[model samples]
Target chain A: MTDALVLLVVVPIAASLFPVALGGRFERIGWFVAAAMGLVHLGLSATVAAQVLESGVISYAVGGFEPPFGIELVADGVSAPLLVLVSLSTLGVLAYARRAGPHSNAFYSELALLTAGISGVFATADVFNLYVFLEITGLATYALVASGRSPRAALASLKYLFVGTIGASLYLLGVGYLYIMTGTLNMADLTGAVASVGYTSPAILTSFGLIVTGLLVKVAVFPLHTWQPGAYAESPDTVSAYISALVSTAAAYALVRIIYAVYTTKFLDEISLAGDALVALASVSIVVGAVLAVMQSDLKRMLAYSSVSQFGLVVAAIGLANETALVGAVVHLVGHAVMKGGLFLTVGVFATGLGVRTVEDFAGLAAKAPISSAAFAVLAFSMVGIPPAVGFVGKWNIVVGAVEAGAWSVAAVVVVSTLLTLAYFGRVIERMYFTAPEPEADAVSTDGGNDAVEVSFGMRAVVVVSAVAAVVLGVLGSDLITVIQPALEVYF
Target chain B: MIDLLTTHYNYIASILLFGIGLYVVMGSPNLVKKIIGMNIFQVGIFLFFVTTGYVDGGAPPVVGHGEETFVSPLPHVLILTAIVVGVSLTAVALALVIRIYDGYGSLDEDVIKEVQVDD
Candidate 1:
């Protein structure tokens, strides 16, 4: 059980190679292998989460090397829930892919590799190890995005590779700067070292600037988010849901970790420009992302834009740098993952069953796919911050935290974001329930095939389960804060 | 200004290399050139990292040399791993570039955009 943190990363990475190695006779067994491994990952992460919640932070030195000299894996209060989220979300997507998939051995291999990479990002206590994991995650994602049949998938993947590599490189440079200043890469050691060097030093300022900017690109903030809409829209539906749920969420979590764990809030208090700049940027992203989402014609593109806006809320919470806001960041990170992942899977259901891909095609979709439409409506309303939903709980905490911090503008922007969320989602909901389906929609099958379009049981179950989890998580939001309170105590 | 440049010439050179790489990546239209630019940019960072470990007259970090002064081997080991990562990244980027060329019959970003629009 103590070794669960390292096993959570190593098991999937080692298993990833097996799928590709099992060539001729065992080709079709890849999904089964991946599924079994997913279960193992779930068990391991659940053990880690239980142990972490019961005790305090669990730290393991690699190969018995101790302290600042060796790489360490940590399972703390903040990372414990995220570890479970990574396992559950990936397992959920794997189930969906069982029915709707490319289903090749190589595809499953990439999926397993991606799981290992994300788990590594969450587990590592070393800054440079985080970079290596970030690159691993980026590499796996690019290949999965390009797994789509269209040539456009190739284009999107390449663009993402270029931009994503640059982002990671910038982060590496920041690490180099820190190493020069503090002579250590361990997160815990850097905390003390950074404070000793003084926050007003130019080297510290530059390093913080580069690190935050690099991560914001990965988080897909507006203006730095050109690669996202195309990648999400062009990839396979399973890929879209998996990456949308985990990738940017992992980056946002890393940002929060870097801000609170490494730099600490004292740096923000001393250098007020840094925190104010983050809040300002996040505020702009909030308004711009919603407006862009409203203007998008394609359903997947709109959802991609919606992520930009949602992450703005998470980043804003991080910038507020108080216990309430920090807890809100963690809550929103999990909430957004469940809601957005569910929304993407629902989009896939519509596309697979009724040949619907655009907002216009969704007119009276309730008649054809009653179950999916209901699930979609529930998830969408949850995203719009209706009371008793996870989205409302997250946004409420952030708004109150901002108000307490006396950042009135940020509080106002967060409130306005709820209505803006309603703006784009409301259009879809209206077309879904209120408007009538077109007469010629029967002939509108874009694939030009007469074969039956089946919506798999696994796919629908995942979407419906996500909606249930969203509302259930909302009611349990306070419990989440209580669990994470110990971790917040270490920070503030 | 001259004293600063002379004293930290390695840092200045690395930053300049990084700047040039960024300019090429953002300015060039060809996909292959963009990837080459990425490599240059990464090498620049590697140089900066490796140079940070250099001491004036310190020997290489092989133990039992009976030398009191030794250049820090940590950054060297780090850059070695970084170099491996850079090579793999370059290989993947080139593979992606080949696929783009095969699919669109062009390596230029502008031409690819026009081809996509026509499709």
Candidate 2:
């Protein structure tokens, strides 16, 4: 079992080295190599997920040593689906990047590195290992952000690096506290040790505070999310879509792990402040992110702000700390990745193909780029929580879960946040479907001057497929729950 | 209070370094200094981890022919890995700063951001 787990991370990382070696002779060999690795990683993850589902949890210690000593890779109900999710998204990004690319050998190398880092995040059972993978992911993201080769991209990436480093440092400091108190780095050992030390100890509380702060910054929760918009807006199109879908999704998943796996629900029960503080922050993020998204004229920046709000819903569900709410968190997580990733891809198509970047520039996009505009609308509706879409189902479960948990205010915020989401996307939808394309205005648009690159069939295909998947996963949400149910039972 | 201060001086020093790094990172407008601040912050975390691995009267984590008390080696190994990561992160950040400087001809955050808005 550890074989597949190790292979899933090692494949992409090891393959990334090949592009530089081979690309010296063949210019676009990076494309073929990355695609091959992505395909292999996807197959390995599917096999691993199937094995985990059929049997129970599988924990394989690396280097033939047992846990609490050697690092362990676990593929249980919790991480198996996420393994599938990150792999699928990586492959989808590869497909999209083939058409719309920075097209450098180094570009695919960073993509491969990012894929390896995320899979490691999804599977590692050691807390310090998680920090290592987090930095790896941050480094890849910083490089990829600068790959756009613009001054703005460089500055944005620099800002991202500064903020991301501080966040990771805070997390390392928290791990230091955990080690000092418990003298263990393994997640399983942490639970018993944390309980023995008492959850209310000032040291334990401070560690929890630092850990959550670092994760929230990574998660891009409201006020701490300053780096997100610039990085997303200024990066090359494919990088924006890829990181938007997975970076925060992986970080949010880590937050779930910390809350439930490392700290445990009992910890939250002992000290409600730990949970309450997160809930308050999430509630503010939901409103503030939506309001900010509404103000952004740039489509990609608007989508970036929308992510702040969407992740707020996920974190709120996490803070509720109920079984159903947690389920909603996972569902919304999967749903948001597909929908938001698809939206960014569509924006990429518009930006590269037609020089459209602003919302106004998207006037009557239906007539110009019909399939992608339709794809955009479908994903937007899903994001708005329309019925039978994955988005609606995730929101339904979360609202019901919040009510069941008697967090009346949280339930209210969840409901209101849905309307706020529609408010921002509604105008874009209206303009796409109803408004006619303005006849070639000469107004100084804010889009960076490089425009009208050829859009390939693979780029459009990836967008359509993700849009369809959002609807399909919505219908199959209940079956997906059955798969995660076993892990959830143990987790809660 | 006197005993607490005397006994925990290493911890207090680490905290002071952390606070100074935080202030420089948040308060300064210079991009390169901010990166230096980031490095200082990581140094604080590394110091904290190393301090936790210290023992009052214990041998280093190497084997003798007999039973012996030793400070834990796990945190040392963990800190080594973390320091590598910190180095790589600094490399990436400095690379970006170089590019930004090349593009805007200024290393000031305020000037670079203002230029981005104007463009």
Candidate 3:
């Protein structure tokens, strides 16, 4: 059982290498092996979750060495849920990629490596190891984004790499500061040392600032988010969907861990200004991102900006630092991943067949591809926080939590942002269903060539599954809250 | 002031190097120079960590007969890993730069942006 921890992190990494090693001679074998590895990872994560729920936290020291000396992997309720989310989403995305037809085998291999790296970020107990995993994930993501056919794809990827490297460098600098202060790299040990040293030390504060800023950049929070819309819009559809689901979510999770696990509530209380600063940035991000999203003409770019808005909501909830708000943050994290991933994948299907990118291109899509269109409508409504959708549940918790924390401004922002969200996506829905297609262009194209714009069964399956999951997760909101409560308690 | 300098020499150097790196990454018009700046920045971090592990006048962490009084080996190991990650990033960034050069025939971001807009 303990060895399972090592296997969970190691298997995907090892498998990622195998496909590359085999090269083109065994492409089918590579895909099979990659898909199998994803399934196995999902199974292992599920097992880890079950054990974590039953047995409290699970700690595995690498090579049988003790912590504060050797690298350790720890899984608490919080990590377990994220681990499961990462694995399951990887599996779904891998399936979608396979069905989408032959991409470079090397790309899938890198995707697997990225998945491994993200899982390692969730699982690793050493701060420096987290930095290493972050690098791996960043490298893999740049490659994935640059794999797109568009010339702009390379430019977007380059920008992402440049900003992302800065973020990574800042993170390393922060880790260096923490190491200098504590003389240890282990997260658990650093937590005690940080508390003992107190938060007033210039070194600790510098580290906190660097780490939070680096993570904010990674999360694409507000001003640092300039790289994201381009990266999200230009990447290959499957790549965009996978990254949309996980990258910022993982960064947000790391931010929460740094605040709650590494620094603790006591340390945060001392740095009252830091917490308030984060909340303020998150507030600005929500309003700014929502406004920018409304102005976007490109459908994918619109959703990308909307993600910036959604991430702000999640970060603000985390910054609030109450149990209810933390729960809201966690739920929002999961909710956004499913809804955004589904929406992106659906858009991918549309773009693949219809050659659509802008909002106007989607006119009358609901009539052309009813099932995919309907799925998009459900997801769009969910993104707007409409009832019986995961987005609604997430927003409801966040709003309720804000009120409980007596953060009336945040509560009001949440309501206003929700309305803004509905306006943008509602406009998209109207364009898809209500607007008429140009008759002259239609007459020039006989056989109703537009009617062939429907997605394949497999792609439709992925959309339906995620769409259903989004609704079911919301419908079972109480159950999710119950499960997430234990995780949220650790923060409060 | 001298005592503070002596005690925190590595810290001062780390900040100085970090600043230099930031200057190049942000200020340099050349793409390759920015990458070089990134490398210098990473080296600064590596140095900070290595220095943190040094107990004053302690021996190297080569375990031997009766040489158990050495500085910690952990930060050294950690920096080695960082070096590998840094090198990997440099390789990828350089590859992207090459691609960008191919696309725009220029390495300056402003020039590239101008060309892209013209296109």
Candidate 4:
């Protein structure tokens, strides 16, 4: 299992390189290699998760050097499930991409690199290594966004690159500060060091501020979310779906790991101002994101903004920092990924088949494409936190956690946001099912343009699988909660 | 003042470099220049880590007799990894800049935006 852990992070990256290097000559073979590697990666991650559940925590020392010296890869209850989530989602996206079309060989390679980077970030126990993995993910995503043929896509990629660099730089600065205070980069060691020195010190506070601020930018927290809508709107539908599902979720997961694992609840209790400050920022993000999302005309852009709001809820739940709230945040992480991934993939199918870009363009979609539209409706309902969908389970936990934390105001914001989410999504649902199709020029020219393009069986398969996961995950909430609860025990 | 300069020179340099880089990233109109600023900022971080490893008048860290008086090599290794990351970032940023120039015929962000609007 120990050796297998290293393979989990390394194989996908190595395999990704092969496809890009040799894939041009052998297209089918390249995809086969990538898919095979993804399945192997999934299998290894699951094995690790099993071990983590049965045994306490698993630590792999790099190069035979122990903690506070060489780099370490640690998997606890917190990291194990996330590792599985990243691998599973990447595999799903890769499978989806295989039949979608012939993406540039370079593009697919970058996507594979991104998979490795995200997996590394989740598994590594060293803070600096985490930053390196972050860069890998960031660079790959920037390229992926730019791979779209549109000029707007290039522009969006540029903005994302700029902001993302700043975020990474700030995070590095925070790490520098932490290193100065603790003289160690190992997370387990740093936790002990931070607790020993007291969390109220100005240095620790400064580090916390820098780290949290940087992560907020990555997570696309409210005011810092200017780059996301454009990026999501302009990227190829397949790329947009995968990134929208993964990037912010990874950042949120990292933030939780840092706050709960690296800096214990005791440290946070000592620095009460820190928690309050985060809660305040999260509240602002939740309100602002939902409001902005409600105002967008473009379908993908609206979903992108909706993600900004959904992410805010995750951060806010984390800020609440109680056990129930933390579980809510984790559940939200997984739930939002399924719901958003399904929605984006469905939209991709619509855009490809119908050439539709705006909500207005979705008119009578339900009649034209019942199965795809049905899938979208289910996802939309899930996004609105309707019962028996995973979204509701996550949202309900957040509400309960907030109420328990005596944060009734935060709970109220969540309630209002859910309604607002429904209102915006409801407009689209109405347009697709009820309204007459507007005779747009593009619509007239192309036989519904691409909108008439039927989603492939394989594409439909991916959508149905994710949609079913959303419902099933919601129904079996107790099982997920049980898996996650052990993780929460370490933090709370 | 001289004592302060000598004692905190690395700190001063890190801050100065970081500020300059930040200014370029935010204030420059040219996209390429902004990328340059990013590089400068990263170099500042590199310096910060290297400085953290310094022990006054110490030799390089190696396992041998008389190596007791040596600065820690750990930060050096950490900065080495960071440097590789920095290089990768530079490559990606430059690639994006090239693409932007291709799309808009200018490296200036304002010009690019104007071109986009005119389109």
Who wins the TM-score comparison? Answer: 1
What are the Cα lDDT values of the candidates? 0.89, 0.89, 0.85, 0.84
- What docking grade does candidate 2 earn? high
Measured with C-alpha atoms, the lDDT of residue A41 in candidate 2 is 90
Each prediction's TM-score versus the true structure? 0.98, 0.98, 0.95, 0.96
lDDT by residue (A1-492, candidate 2, tens digit) is 449988988999999898988988999999999989988998999988889988868777888888988888888876888888888888888888887788999999999999999989888888999999999899999999999988889988888888888998898899889989998888988888999999999999989999999989999998999999999999988999889999998899889888788899999998998788889999999999999999999999999999999999999999988999899898898899999999999899888777778888877779878999889989999998998999998899899999999999999998888898898899998888898876653133324536646789989999999999999999999988887768767767
lDDT of each residue in A1-492, candidate 1, tens digit only: 579999999999998988899946786878987888899999999999999978879998888889689999999988899999988998899889888886889889999999999999899899998988888889889989988867788889988988888888899999988999999999999999999998998999999998998899899998788888888999999999999999998888889888888899999999989999999999999999999999998999999999999999988888988778778888889999999999999999888887788899899889878988999999999999997989988898889889889999999998899899999999999999999987776567545333264788999999899999999999998898888778877888
Please list all clashing residue pairs in model 2, or write none if there are none.
none
Worst 10-residue lDDT window, candidate 3 chain A: A444-453
How much is A106 displaced in model 3, in angstroms? Answer: 0.4
- Chain B TM-score for each model? 0.97, 0.93, 0.92, 0.94
Which residue ranges in model 4 land beyond 4 Å of their true spot?
A440-442, A445-454, B1-3, B63-67
Write the candidate numbers in order of decreasing DockQ.
2, 4, 1, 3
Better of 3 and 4 by lDDT: 3
Query: Distance (Å) between predicted and true CA of A251, model 2?
Result: 0.7
User: Candidate 3 — which residues are off by over 4 angstroms?
Assistant: A440-454, B1-7, B65-69
lDDT of 2 by residue, B1-119 (tens): 88989999999989888998888999999989998888888898898888888888878878772537788888888999998998898888888888888999999988977887888
Model 4, residue A129: displacement in angstroms?
1.3
Counted clashes in each candidate structure? 0, 0, 0, 8
Please write out the lDDT profile of model 4 over residues A1-492, one tens digit for every residue: 577677777887888788778876886666677678788988989999999888968889888998778889988776787888777787777767776744567776777788888888888888888888888889889988988887678779988988988898888888888988898889888999988777887888888888888888889998888889999989988888888988888888888888887887887788778888888888888888888888999999999999988998998888888889889899889889888988998988777777777887888889878988998999999989998999999999999999999999889999998998998899999999999786674456356554334457778888888888889989988788888888788777
Query: lDDT tens string, model 3, A45-131?
Result: 988889888887898999888987889998887788888988878877877776674357788788888888889888888888888
